[model samples]
Target: MTGAPAMTDSLLAVWHAYRLPILVAVSIFFVTLRVYTQSQSRPKTAASSSVPVSPRGQSPEKSQKLDAPAEKPIAPQNPTTKEIFKPAPKSVKPASGPKRVQGKKKPAKTIGGRRPSNEDNDNGPPVSFIQPIVFFASLTTTTERYANAFFPPQLHDISYIDFDDFFTTVPPSSSPDTRYVYCILIPTYNIDTVLSTFLGHLDETHNDFRIDTAPLANLAGYSVFGFGDKEEWPTEEQGFCSQAKEVDRWMAKLTGRKRVYPLGMGDVKSDAENALKDWTEGLLDIFGDILEYGGLGEGVRGSGDAMESDEEDVEDEDESQSGKKKSSTMVDLEDIKMNGDSAAPLPVDFTTVGKAVTVTETAKEMVPKTSPTYTALTKQGYSIVGSHSGVKICRWTKSALRGRGSCYKYSFYGIKSHLCMEATPSLSCSNKCIFCWRHGTNPVGTTWRWKVDEPELIFNGVKEGHYKKIKMLRGVPGVRAERFAEAMRIRHCALSLVGEPIFYPHINRFLEMLHNERISSFLVCNAQHPDQLEALYRVTQLYVSIDASNRESLRKIDRPLHRDFWERFQRCMDILREKRSYQRTVFRLTLVNGFNVDDEVQGYANLVEKALPGLVEIKGVTFCGTSTSAGAGLTMKNVPFYEEVAAFCVALNAELERRGLHYGIAAEHAHSCCILIASDRFKVNGKWHTRIDYQRFFELLEREKADGTPFIPEDYMMETEEWAYFGKGGFNPDDERWFRKNAKPRPTHLIPAEAQAQVDAHVQAQDS
Candidate 1:
């Protein structure tokens, strides 16, 4: 206690000496504390706002780093876009524009490993429209032309653009409401091209583990079209349009099966222009669907799998995992047999297969189920057989079934139209004939590089397909039970459908199969394939389509694809000269009014003198006023009148006689605007015998096959019907008259005089 008092007294003395200074320091300390407390208690003012405000999921430090006024993105000319995810350092900054060049500032929810589609993203601003980006890679400029023909806003020449812009991630949206869609037009090369480089990038993007597998799933949809040299690589197995197929598959995976339309392919040398146009029109229709309904149309989505595109080297997880694929619309029964399935399917389905079979999955078909050509042919009422062959119900057969009348064939050759099957083993032709009903819709090529279907497969498939179509016609208004029963037997195979039948590699075998089945073969060819014509098998009758009388006229009318098309045609004439002794060669002339009908008689006679065909069939051109014909300058006036056709036939006959050719007008089918001239071999006892005894033809074919014995067409000759003789109308005795729909009672010789005169003058000038 005494020590404490002593210390306190010393302290008191010291405090007294420093009392003034101590009191001042104590006051300053309390004042500073009060100021700090007051500042802390009060709300922040503008001056105290130096601390960073954190984003929802970010730390304050990171938020502060982001707080720096973002260096306005230095967009270069043609900026590479990856605006959805910040995958690279370059993407860390926002995209440069308010046009949604950058995605929304906030993150999007990932569902099933990808951003949800516009349909699933109701929580965000709705997608208002679909923005299409056409991507193409061309080697020889053919594919580039097709790309330009596509809907506008294309990035043609993928070589000029950065692949990372598209393949790396989902594309940046133009606006929050604008969804992206890819329309790709690619060409395939046997050798590597920039297209191959693009494919490599696409494959890398799909397989990269760092990115989501379906990173592009946010896209509305995608489709692809391809161009290839059909002459060099006719099928996808040999690399025709192969790179496009690869892109399609990769995009399917990347977009989570958002394929808007099926893959389409065209031949660079033949029909790429028309085929690409058709494909674009179809995509536009689908785009309308996406904009209005906000999705790929029903059942159209999720169809871009391995099986839909004739894909090779792919395993379908959906079918493999499930061990069974249920398809209510699969119509290719061969698929079951090809896959060794014990169960049989319904006999004839109107729908095509939804997925390809195991065998077809490993190679490209001439016409894939998903191809636009297949769709168009089917729409035009063709029953596709196997991959290449097709069978269609002929209007003449319909007429016969209705007891209206048989076709011109029945009048000229004495074969009942009801018992004939109009079909072709190959649907690919070498020409786009202006008068062809299937010219604009069918596939064309200059070679036979596609997969070769077996003769048995084609034979059996075509028969069934033909019979099925005939059965479907039973429901029509026509009623003739007796004729319908005859139609079921398919006594004759008329190989005169949309394409050159001889183009099929196994054409001879197909003919042998037909002959073995007692079905007579009547084959027609486009004369552009002389080698095939030389190797053709014996048929009930053989016909060469003489579309134009001269080279210039042929080029304009037929549009042959061969570089030496005229030479090939003349080669066919020589081959016919060699074939006429044994085969019943016929020259079938299709007289186009303004294209081939004026002053072509001399030219036709020259070809006749060279080939010396056993018979010359002259017929007027017939088109149903379709857009395809319209595009080729055909109109109602282009169809020649029956009288004009007869006059031309008479003129041609007179020219042949002047050349000392022993041909005489034998038969006419006035109702159908057809006439026939036969060599004197068929004229006996001053009577014409142009018709063939089909039974005798089959017998002779079988005999020749069995004993190595050969027979001439004359061996199976039969007398022509009295009503089918030259001055007669040639309408069948048991049938009623059938006029064209909406045809006036007057004659149909309404060809435009000016067009004919123009062609005549041009031809005369060319000759001079």
Candidate 2:
């Protein structure tokens, strides 16, 4: 025991001296062994095992010896090419740039070569085939007016491609190396418009599962600028430039997130100019970048999460730069090519009321499939045919089909109202008439610049539309099957539905098309275009609307667009006077009370004498309650009563007698508040020869066309029915008589003393 204690004491003394050094050595040895084992177990990535090289990309063997390690370095698998050029993350903006986006130091993409990116796309090889195309759509000419003032001549020159050119299917680049950039200028409309059609097309283009998700990936990029009415829409959330935002989203998806700039929105009434300018500057920057980089630049530069905004969309590279990013700007006025000339882009052949007009080489659609006007008209029981013509079913046609009374024409001119198809060859006019009921939906142009639908096209289309509309009424309660079948034949055509028929360039052909099918045409003119009136072809009956008696009153009633409207009006009267001999010319007077009726007896008498028309068809104004008519100060009070119309016709007849004109009251259709005054030549055997012989009229027309056979208005005149004479109600006994429901009583003081007895009889008949 004594000896063990001594040995332990010696061991303890040595342990104390070397304990610290011994512990340090043990820790170091364990750490080195653990580290070496962990290193051997770790996964070897390409980046980790990649050969280290110098800054100049030269192998390290040239400078220093690379001693081989104990274990062979894991050979890093080669990355596929797709992984090298994979699409960047969504958050990435352009990583590269022109470094010359100011358009000053950098050449445009189309003009010269650009710097190469990491790889060569189809548009690369030190040069780019970037084509920036501009597109626009206009309705009220506001968009066109702005585009004319805003876009550059060269850009406008290559711009104005039809929406169908690319909206449905992306057009392939001219070459495999080429790429396109669409710069769209758009307008916002609440109503269904062509822009709506375009948006729908975009929607379909992307949503269609049959097509590739990014079918337009070949496109270099796209941008949009929108025009909106701030007074109405106020903000994008409320629909201001909503279409443009939608376009941006779809285009981004279509082009594989290839948004060139940002979405621009401009308030037409407010900050459009400044907004468009700012947007244009940024767009110019992108153009410069495209020229230099041959793309919108890969990774990301000046990009953000694609988003919407109240006024505009702003983009950024990342969340850190969100606040610093520029807001999306307006469109149109500033995105013109920098080729120097700043001519207007021709999206269509239309001009604003006061802008300089440049006729396009091709005639464009006046009422395109996307126009809001088309929607309005279609909703108003009208079927739009071709580009401009429209066919509608008149209430008289419906009434006649139900065995109710026909229109006044049937009582006086012997037309079966149900067989009369109402159609117009043109849906444009030169007047905004106060009494017109069109609701301002029709286009008003001083000239005809729209596409001319072929006469046969209009003819076939209108007939089909009319027949189709008529067929829809087959299940109605009171439709007579025989009348409906007869209606399909279209015996008579009233070319007076909502537009100026003569505005059509091929009016004669349209009329001939009618005549060829044995359909009689009753065409009415607004009496504004003297040239068209003079060149008018033979019609069964041609009526000139004598809206007013004098120049000032005519202006008040017609609201004509031409500066020399009065001169044109007077010229139409002279032309009518010449046409009265061969053409069945009639002066159709619309007496609007408080505007053109009071104290205008002598003035109308002067017009009648000036034209010496075959007949004077005077009717009270029909109230078409619409905002446009209300804007012109028209109201229900402006519509004259039947008694007032008759008294006015009486006074007019007396005035004609005083002027030594051979005209007298021949017939009356009090239901429509209308009366016909015939010339002495039609007063055969003390009876009115006012009605037309339909077959004879057609034969005369065909003879005239075939051999230049001359004919007169009296050649086919037939005797008027006895019930259509003066003082008769002009109701067709074969058809039932009906009155409007809840109609109000009218004053009788406006009636002439002699007509009071007849008015009392009519009142008694109405009471019964």
Candidate 3:
């Protein structure tokens, strides 16, 4: 027993002496094994492949000490789980070459890996360690060229893959020790589309892919950028910078990262040096940062400059064109012909100029910067129209297109509703008439307080909007294809849509555009701007909406915004009376039941005598319902019955007789509860002169430019008859004469008599 204890003591002493050295050796072995296992598990991607970078050019490993705490690891997946990522086809070779310059073409490759005879296979060394797989979408050839110039291959390891092949082009499978940095470039033209598409990939369907994006939440590890032309943006204020701001917001919401850079480019070649160069330099810096650091760098807020412009230059141009030196009512023939050679300036008169407001460059700023209200209006069957104007598909217009019925204008004056386009040059109105059916929520202004769009732009936009409306109606249940086709080429423009058309500072210019387009204009003014009336050129039909008879009723019904409302109304009437020559002037009285239809017939007659309109249309107020604020205040009681309207017309005719005026009830539209009174002046040789000779009117305008010679009212007057009215024997659709009188050819098309005849026949057939 003593011998055994002595042996144990000796072994214990030996162990105690070498304990420190033994522990050190075992620790070294475990450290070496752990590092080796980690290296083996690392991803085998190309050396120059994309990786997250830091703001300062430092490697991720070196910057690791500076960064925040690392994200927690995702739970391990089952080894038996099937891999979803498939390998790319062998036929598809990765792009490899020296960084190519923009506009340089690569040699064509032969089918199935065979080099074309024209090219030399002397394929030089690969310029980059990683052959990039770029995916591009919705980019035009020119855009692609520009993008290539910005991201040269020498600088970037990018592969330009077709946008369609992106999702289908399977990515490399993820491993426990490795993650990929995906960079996405989107076009600003289709921002909504591209963003939605990218987000769609992260839906529940991708849950089984075992791709964890937790690391990207803190660091902008996955890169995404947008680029587009600055000019293509909707507005200057909301264009480049605004869109970029939106991108930033959306990125933060979707990816939980606030890293997004939008590179603004030019719409034309001139912008290359300014916008394009700056973006290119910025891109290079981004690449350098990414290469140095292992994460996306700090987001770029500004690229030194944006699509900046000189406001003074634009104002100077506007001043030069509008000519502030001249009288507000003066129409310069030379300036009128500036946009188009065929147009002539309308006659100018300063005799009865009321206190008017001119829309200068300063006032342009007051104009609604955004049209959110108009955007909502579009959803209510309105057209996708105008830069600053609006057009709506009227019930009458819809009915005519479907051969169901026509508008009151069609029955009153031989106007064809299918050929008419209802629009407004201005969305703001001076008066908020209580009986008005338009949306009460529309913008209102006392004077011209907004930017006036160019006539050419307005005309083109309105016509395009009309075309879109007709196109949409093509498949509608009641709309006839043939009628819809006729509606595409507008013949007449009714300026009675919503706001006052004359509210636009360029009213005369807009009228000239319409005349030049061979589209007859029917301008309706609320008599608030007499100066505009004096400045206006000739139109097919000019209706003054005499909402009330005298000063008190006018204030009550019309609700004029101007403090000198009575003076303006009287002055506008005087100008209308003077403008009877070369234009069809009419006084439109909306007969309200408990409002103006009382003992005010004499008052209306006296005012009518003073104006001496060619025709006086006394129509019952239509209860278009009260959705608008002004409309909400009005009730159905204000609407007059057909019998009540007829009595008022009769009383007004009697009053006209008392004043020795030759005005008489020529026609009536019972459906609209409207009565048309034709003055004896229009009844030359016992025939009604209601229809307009649009061709002769334009000829006179062109001829009378030099001496400012005014054409007489009889110059373009056409014969009308009592039978032409609704319920009259003259209202036959089969009557070719009536059709010819109403269905004039638009400037856009050579509308043959056969087309009008076909439309009439269709309407008659439907009625039968």
Candidate 4:
């Protein structure tokens, strides 16, 4: 028994020493056994096994290896014959069935470890034949703008799906291949969040069929292009939004190489057209030969004349007349050759582009009103007055010409609608206000970025643009010939067209040119640049569009690009107050229904008291089209009604009274949903003097220039009698009696009695 214990102890020591190595060997043996078992038990699906490779594409040895138990790979019966490429059959799935996705496989069974017989697939190669291309646009406008830019129907059958409906229409089971690439167009703004949401949905559905089996990685196969305003994506480092940069980086990482092209947003036809060309070029790079003729065809073999023949055939068919529908059926070479050269090819015309086959064209039909250049501006209903200048016939101008109504400018400042020329010397602005009717694509700049056209050129251009516009209405159904002729005369120039006129470098000279032409100038400034306001000379009336009453409100409403814009605006107001005694100043408030219309009484009063504006025009914001910026989402409900505008005016007037200010509500124009509050200084002997005395003002300017004396605004001021708001003496062009009774002679009938003698002398001297 003692000997047995000693033996056991020795055995235990040996066991301990070998235990580690024994455990390692056992683990290895078990792993190998499990792997072998798995290899035997795994099912041989068609994708991984059973499909035999053709000897024509692979060596016999390789083919044998692929289908180890099958017979020798079949060789062509005719060694000298070349494989003829055949067109795929037309996609025939019913509307309710799963779509024919690119790279998708047709379910087929193996015949004794060999691929389906050649006769089974009509002697075609066992490859998926359909290629589907889809576009996921971030905005309706984006899709509309770029729909025809890439994948013109002549070359590709592209489909568009709305952002909301895309996932539902295209299931995760849909496959993609080298022959089929998809596109996802997303706005740079908030793209990170959008992609995350998209990927989360894919993961929730357990979609692992896509390329690289990762959501973002799948997008690597797509050719991406982005277009937006530089300001809209204003990050100095990337020259685009930070989110856009992240998307670019993600694409680069996923694709491992390809770069995204950035096309700066421009309000011109060429911008969209050029963006499309760029996208086509990028696609060409990605797809290589697949984009060329015969690339997508199967078994396309041979060289020289054979390939040329196919190209010639395609070209001949493409030569069909514009708008002609071409058949998708493949034309057989023998059939085409049999037709002979005597059969003239259909006349080829590529000018007429077809509309998108599947999507609604409503978005496409809405052309953006704003543009970047004179020519494009003209197409958008503006008259390119001159270099960097344009004119457009206002709705009020049309109304007055038809004897239907007049603009608020007419009622408030006695500006004859027919005689006023709505012109601007600059088409760019410093602010991108949400309520602006101008397209977001319009150019934005804090300073001049282009060559300045001469003042004379601008003047002539304005005249020509205005004349052309007026001529078109000469024989209009409702237009009065007399009024139309008067409109052609162009007595007044409202430099408040589409942009900040003060930004025009030659603005001062432009005003002088207008005055010299005996045309009164009414210049409008956005008050973002104080220096521009300080240098201003003479104008019949000057308007500062005060979009917001407070600094925070200003930033939200105006969306000014300048960091110190509020400071500059305040300085501009102070300058206006300084020039109050020298020039007529007006503060224009564009009240939005949901913005800047609440708790602004004191703010408005503070500005009024500081600037002492001759008049305050409180008008409601007009919501039109759609907003690209989510923050600027506005609807018809966001447009305040006339009563709301009046209520706001009443509140402002009450605040002014509380502060003992002299401004009071002077008039209301219900049609425009606007109210005018005027300074008591605009009244003479308790009578409102709203109508401008153009003649006296012009005479005074001439006298000041001839005598080399500084002109004071009060020197030529005239007394006024208040007109009825809605009765006999009210300002309504429709009511001939009131208009006729209230209408004063053009220019200077109200000159002070004391200045009559001087005015007569000056006129006599001028005639001599």
When sorted by TM-score, best at the front, the candidate numbers are 2, 1, 4, 3
Q: Give me the displacement of residue 737 in model 4, in angstroms.
A: 12
Error of 1 at 512 (Å): 0.8
- Model 3: per-residue Cα lDDT over 1-768, one tens digit each: 799999999989988887544543453344334433442443321223332221111211233353343332232121100110111111212122111111111222344654222123222322111212322222223334444434432111111121112221222222222323333444443222222233333331122133332212322223344454555564545564343334343333333342323434344334533454444334333332332222232222311112223343366468768857633544455555555565433332221123223434453432232433444456455553444587776766777776766756666666778888888888677675766654433555565445556777778888888777777777777777778878878888999887788878788888888887788888899998887788887777899999888886676566655557889899998998888755678899897655566679888877887888888888888776733312123456566556566666666776788888887766766656777888776677756776666677777777776578777767876777455642352332632321335766534333334434543443364246
The best candidate by TM-score is 2
**TM-scores, in order shown?**
0.55, 0.56, 0.49, 0.53
Clashes of each: 0, 11, 15, 5
Tell me the spans in candidate 4 whose CA falls farther than 4 Å from its real position: 1-376, 385-387, 626-631, 716-730, 733-768
lDDT of 1: 0.68
lDDT of 2 at 688: 85
The alpha-carbon deviation from the true structure for residue 133 of candidate 1, after best TM-score superposition, in angstroms, is: 21
**Can you tell me which runs of candidate 3 are displaced by over 4 Å?**
1-372, 384-387, 627-632, 705-710, 725-768
- Model 3, CA-based lDDT: 0.53
For residue 477, what is the lDDT in candidate 1? Answer: 88
Q: Candidate 4, 2: how far from true, in Å?
A: 99
* Model 4 lDDT, full chain set: 0.54
lDDT of each: 0.68, 0.68, 0.53, 0.54
**What is the lDDT, from 0 to 100, of the residue 513 in candidate 1?**
85
Per-residue lDDT over 1-768 for candidate 2, one digit per residue giving the tens place of the 0 to 100 score: 799999999999999887644643453344335433433543221111211111111111221232322222232233111111122111111112011111101211222354344144343343233445556666565655555445422222111122223543455333344445667778876553445445645655565555565566555567888898888787677988988877787777666566778788899887775576566556545644554455554344322122323122233234337566432323365676667686655432221212233456676787877767887688788899999899999999899999998989987899988999999999888776767777456776767667778988999999999999899889998889898888878899999998899989889989888988899999999988888888888889999999989986786577665657888889899999888888888889998877788789989998888989999999999887753344345677677778778878877887888888899888889888899988998878877899999999888877887899999878899999988877778999898777679977655575556656655554454346
